[model samples]
Target: MDKAYRFEGTYLQWLKEELTGWDRFPWALFGFGVGFQLAILLLNPINWIAVVSFIGIFFGMWCTVAMGAGGYDSEGNRVSSHAINGLLGSISVIAYVIINVSAGHYWSVLDQLVFLFLIDLPLLKNWRTWSGKSTEIKGLTKMGWLYVIVAILAAWFVLYYVGIYLHDTNPLWDALALAIGGTASWLCFRQYSTTYTLWLISDFVNVLLWFTALKDGYSQAALPMLAMTLFYTATAIVGKINWRPNKVQ
Candidate 1:
């Protein structure tokens, strides 16, 4: 077999062996998320889109926590929970976009669109890993740092212009959240452990973003999103610990 295949096989074997020990799932966190989403659903039983978004949000949150805490499948294979999270997150954001569009909140639609791109990166990375391609986590190279800088600058400029000039929304918070979160997503796609650090920063900014939106009566949907960011912030801390440089491939 080719060297790439051999390497991937070795990696999978290592993961399987590593997961053979006492690896317990975080059922408490999962239960809490389920309860939270169910409460939202009970309150908005007629809003099917909200129901769909809640389903997606719950799975996305669960998978993100699982990934941070080192998840394994029934067969002991390391589960690419980010892939699942990304897919469900995309669905959730799409539903949010529709909701925003119907409410004439074009800026919120734009925000959700950007979020879709961020989450989809992990799905792309997972596809590469599953296709016998290299998806090894590594430290950022100089070029990678440059790319991040450029991306953040570009994202900030556009988000600032759109959010400030066109909408009455919190522009700075939106810009910061998207810029940092986009960087984190790109780093994640490149398989860098440092993505967790960036994600931690982004998650805090996102909490502020949605919290302010809810406070200003932007959308009642912001409540669940705010809670989601808080959960993500906690998981990002877990990911930082679990995906430290020494532990990464």
Candidate 2:
């Protein structure tokens, strides 16, 4: 807690910690996830928005890791509060959607725009400890249901615009992914353990979304999402296995 998970540690050390299961938060796996995205971005013929999304995801993931490791109470209960990560990540997704829509890549990003707007709640709260660290992670709260409602509305909106801006023939799955993905993101900001579970479902949908894009000639764009999906699957598994109640609670 004093050092915010000591993010400054050497790569070898981080790797060793992950391999040996010495680190509680799976920093090594998360780090690998980031690296995978970075590689895909570098190798692909991507635009600036893609790069921006990468930066957003990079900063968001690392910030979440830091915030998670940084926050705690006197009894050592892990804090669930955060702001910057949620903001950065949502913005990243927005940029991704905008670029994709403008480029006519697919309706996935366009469809996902609805949920992205709600992700700002975490930033609005800016929950932190008196020491300027994170606070204990709490349950889904009433907000979880709100996310569900928002997702549903977003899904409907996606379907409504399908014929207008989208031509996917069958965008049902993509819309489902966006609905769930947006909720999953919101859940993560709320520090709900269930976020990983929701994300697992979302990630699977994303796999389909990107794969569909690849089928439609967006290979470079799809690759990163695919790579991220694989890593997301891994992280979801790890997160669920390691989840626990607040130490203080």
Best candidate, TM-score: 1
Deviating ranges (above 4 Å) for candidate 2: 1-25, 46-50, 63-76, 80-83, 102-116, 129-165, 168-170, 185-192, 241-249
* Candidate 2, run of 10 with poorest lDDT: 126-135
lDDT at 123, model 1: 53
> How many backbone collisions does model 1 have?
0
TM-score of each: 0.70, 0.60
Q: How many steric clashes between backbone atoms does each model show?
A: 0, 5
RMSD of each: 5.7, 7.5
Candidate lDDT (C-alpha), each? 0.62, 0.54
Model 2, residue 132: what's the lDDT?
22
List pairs with backbone clashes in candidate 1: none
lDDT of 2: 0.54
Tens digits of per-residue lDDT for model 2, 1-249? 223433344545433332331244556766777977887787767787677657656654554343233234334544433234444456556656654564354545654454455445444333231122333434454676577667767765766477345564336666666667666666654456666677677778777766776677644455665666666666566555444435322
Residues 63-166 of candidate 1 have per-residue lDDT tens digits of 56644665554444443233444555665676666655543445556656765675554454553243111134466666767887788788888878876776
Q: For model 2, how big is the CA root-mean-square deviation?
A: 7.5
